[model samples]
Target: MAGLTAAAPVGQPQMLTVVLEGLRSHKGQILVCVTRSADHFPDCTKDPDKRHFAVPVKNGPIPLGTVAPGDYAIAIVHDENGNGKLDTFMGIPREGVGFSRNPVLRFGAPSFGSASFSVAGAPVEQAIRLKYFL
Candidate 1:
């Protein structure tokens, strides 16, 4: 038998790939935030342990890197203004917003449970569709 490494190296976290969709235009930057705490679900600002990434806006897959095995929720913002933050008007998001599981966006951001997913020994993928409101 051709024997090789059976699994990932010790201390190596599981990989996560985020497939992005529904970007209004190719401008500004994309912000990806991952959190394990429900309290910091969509906002993620209060969670010091949250994983955040900023990439140029484009139509493609976003590699969010490795994470420990656990339940997690992701929030992504299409910052059209490149302000490094999601803009809003009267609590309404002026830029594009998205969640891990592509949950329905009502009057406000969805709860953590609505977009939660699990990462185990294997790789994980989450597809999110950005939503926009003027």
Candidate 2:
């Protein structure tokens, strides 16, 4: 006996869902950036092709969905003033910021290689804790 089989399409794009933790307050939006290049790791504004998303900062984690499959590094900035940019005081960020792998903070943001993770064909989740400098 032969029967029809329902199989998922081959080579479907994967998704990377990021959940941000330790938000200071629910005042503004959360700026999220995902980059596949080391040259444009933390700053998505510098690269016009990089993927960026923004959502309100609630008490819990914020989820981002439907991301393409690939090796990528993520950056998040809690824009407390909804200024569409990370406010800085003397070259240091005043808002809460985070990275995908929660790399050690030495001088500056982590390199793409240090934070990068691969998304094959399944949904991946990353939980990042926000860090505030001020």
Candidate 3:
């Protein structure tokens, strides 16, 4: 009798998917920034280097998908007034914004390293809570 070998399970390439929720209203553009580099910090600030996608939201879970496997950080800002910009007051954001992992925001936005995570060999899911200020 010949011994039979078991076949290994096929691995799927990793993908990062973000589900944006708790949107009060979609008055402006939502910008999603994904990056592999965190050395310079605030990678979203750089014009050409950052991989950014802007989508219009009308209050629901917006799924951002097809992200390749790697170290990455995400930043989302709700340009609530449709000015194509984040409104801030007294060094604090007046409009809705979000970050990966949804770290507790304090005096300033969390560092890229704090929000960075590794994605490999499978799909990853993240639920971001939207923040709003009156």
Tell me the lDDT of candidate 3: 0.72
Tell me how many clashing residue pairs each candidate has: 0, 0, 0
- lDDT-superior candidate, 1 or 3: 1
lDDT of 1: 0.87
Superior candidate under TM-score, 1 versus 2 = 1
Q: How many backbone clashes does candidate 2 have?
A: 0
lDDT of the candidates, in the order given: 0.87, 0.81, 0.72
Off by over 4 Å in 2: 1-10, 59-61
Largest TM-score belongs to which candidate? 1
lDDT per residue (tens digit) for residues 36-107 in model 2: 888888997777668887887775545666656578889999999999999999978899999998888667
Clashing pairs for predicted structure model 3, backbone only = none
What ordering of candidates by lDDT runs from best to worst?
1, 2, 3
Clashing pairs in 2: none
lDDT of 3 by residue, 27-49 (tens): 77887777777763444667455
